[model samples]
Target: PVEIGGGDVGVGCDERGCNLVDHHRVGGLERVRAAVASVLDVEVTAATLLTPERWKSLAGSVGSVPVNLAGELVAASGDGTSVVRFPAGTAQVAASDVVDFFSFPGEVGGAGRIDRQRDWWKSWMSAVGSGKPDTNLPALDLDVIHLLGTVAGGRVRVPVGPWTGGEDVPTIDQGRLVDLVVAMFPVPIPQAPGLRPTVRLLNGTGDRSVDSAARQAVLRAGVELVVVGNYRSAGVIQTRVLHRDPADQPAAAALAAALGGGVLHDEFLSPVTDLTVVIGSDFRMDGQ
Candidate 1:
């Protein structure tokens, strides 16, 4: 009926939090309400859901494997009864299920046990910027698809390279390198102001080189690295991304993804940092 614009947060899972059991069992959703507030620059007390289009797609989603992080939304009709997606890749749902999909974690963006929730918003803008156009997703639903595309396209510029150092690495430590782990297709990312999360890195292996490489990887995650130092114990065998605040889980997820992988933990909440990444000896770039 009318095009409305407001601060509405959509949480997603691959299956739309619509499991036969544990309906609310969304991954990494502990404090997502707050993390999303930081992400959307809104005072979000709760998540906003869509119906029919996005709802049914997410709820009735069949595959457990994660699709593109920057999924797709095919058609946005003017009458408001259009189909949608987490980002919009495969299905078109009913208007009623739109909000229901939003209720599902697959629609939400961030970390979790499932690929749907893990890194949902990570590749959205890049996917949208391929110079390819979707006629159905053009502008009729500017209220929804276009707006989200614009916001997602404004992600902070962070590079993904040299995390696992090699001779091929460039001398320049200032720009982004391709992270094959997260994105199969790479696009130049834009900027989103005032929402950058903070991070801290601890060298658990007691290896300065490991610390150096991880710092390089932070460029990929795009979050501000406030601290880079040592983990008290060098005995750590595996890297870890730790945050005490549930609100920081999103940041932890992003960092973990950039580092290729890490043991994500909700413990060790710190007033000084949003996330602490303890670099383990096991840390290595994918396929490195």
Candidate 2:
């Protein structure tokens, strides 16, 4: 929980949008909130389903402080001073460090109520399959975790006391921090038994012969190679695996895992293959 002190911070909205106000003027907290919220959303329904025992366990593990912002608890903080505990670390913030806090709507992060319901059911089924109580679940909301990091000032570089040392303190990488938060929410990908989907390799990185090297690695992993070609966009940076059917997601996920790391997309353009693997500049055959 970040302990906020100093600075008069409040929430306000206008023609532009919601913003953080400090002594009747705009401040940095709104920008910080938007920057973090743009990439994440806290699903309140999923959070609500967590039993008090489960919440306690998750808080102990991740150091999250789940509080209702609309309740009297926030009012008790007194004049924009509050403590917000996030997963990354604890911080002392001023009123200028915080904007208004609110709950996400039923539709957030392109996921609606139905999608959340389906996810909840899937989570329940997974727990039942593993013969574990629902209380043992990991925190499933990435947005909430990211917000915690944001409030904890995980994205920005701040002075760590007086530094009279040899090496300068490294700036925190927001991308890596988000990735760490993502790693906390583990979802079970279903794989089809005895199914080896054909892979169409595309070189998106424009690197010389990188696709050829990747092909060898894929072949070593026993993934079937249907074709090798150049991707439409040469500027693509991250390696990705696209599957034609939802049922083949596990195959795509397996192929991605075997190849080190890759984002999975639900779009297959190839007529002959069930999966399309694009090799980007970030990809290394050695998994570096």
Candidate 3:
């Protein structure tokens, strides 16, 4: 059996069945289920719910013990089952095991990817707060959950903190939660269209190697490289896409999309090439 502990959320599972112990009843199981499916790459049949006390008792009976979620803990028993125990119930899925317990924070992207995800989440939250329709935001959350779930194998859980109704539910905003989740489990950049854009790559950062790395990334994404050099400035922190003509905006967007983050600028009557990509220090060559 696998035992997981997070804030107030607990999970215990074995090959025969599984259980979830949540202090605050919210809508996270569906997300958990999606994570499981993504990790295991298989359909989940069912799960048996149990009370916290009952789950604790059962866990104890099976040599399970609570541990601090200070960092990350992964344990495997002689039976070949793995259990990931965390204080906040934030554990990734394990690769193998008929029975496993896992939990993860709301945000899952690591290092360089976190900032971009945070910005993306902020944009969406701002739109939502402005009373604009954010139908696609929910899908993005699911996408992140699914991706994290797949990494761990089908057994994952997330604690939604306490629920006191109204504004007392949690001080942290949902956008922040999304940021955390994305930080923990970054999504893959979507592939650019086959109609590749001719790109002029320039390294805005002093790092000379980034230009070469960016070229390979652009090429892997099926984009054509017209020129490679250094930018006029060396202080760019974020990538940017400049199009000389309005007609090439789509091409610039496609190239930017492949790089994951960038601001598209219309240079209008400039005499540059088709598309230009200014690689900044924040440009991630590892992809995530």
Model 1 lDDT per residue over 41-66, tens place:
33444444444555343323322223
Model 3 misplaced stretches (Cα beyond 4 Å):
1-196, 268-270
lDDT of 3 by residue, 155-267 (tens): 23343322222221222344444333333322222123224566777888989867656766665554556677888889889987888777877777777787876757666
TM-score of each: 0.33, 0.32, 0.32
Instruction: Evaluate residue 177 in candidate 1 and report its C-alpha lDDT on the 0 to 100 scale.
Output: 23
Give candidate 3's total backbone clashes: 32
Name the candidate, 1 or 3, with the larger TM-score value.
1
- Total backbone collisions for each predicted model: 35, 7, 32
Q: What would the per-residue lDDT of candidate 2 be over residues 158-259, giving only the tens digit for each residue?
A: 222121212212223444443333333222111221245677888888876685567765654545566778998898788888887888888888888877
Q: Provide the overall lDDT of each model, using Cα atoms, as 2-decimal numbers.
A: 0.47, 0.46, 0.46
Q: Which candidate achieves the best lDDT against the true structure?
A: 1
Candidate number achieving the greatest TM-score relative to the actual structure: 1
Query: What order do candidates take by lDDT, descending?
Result: 1, 3, 2
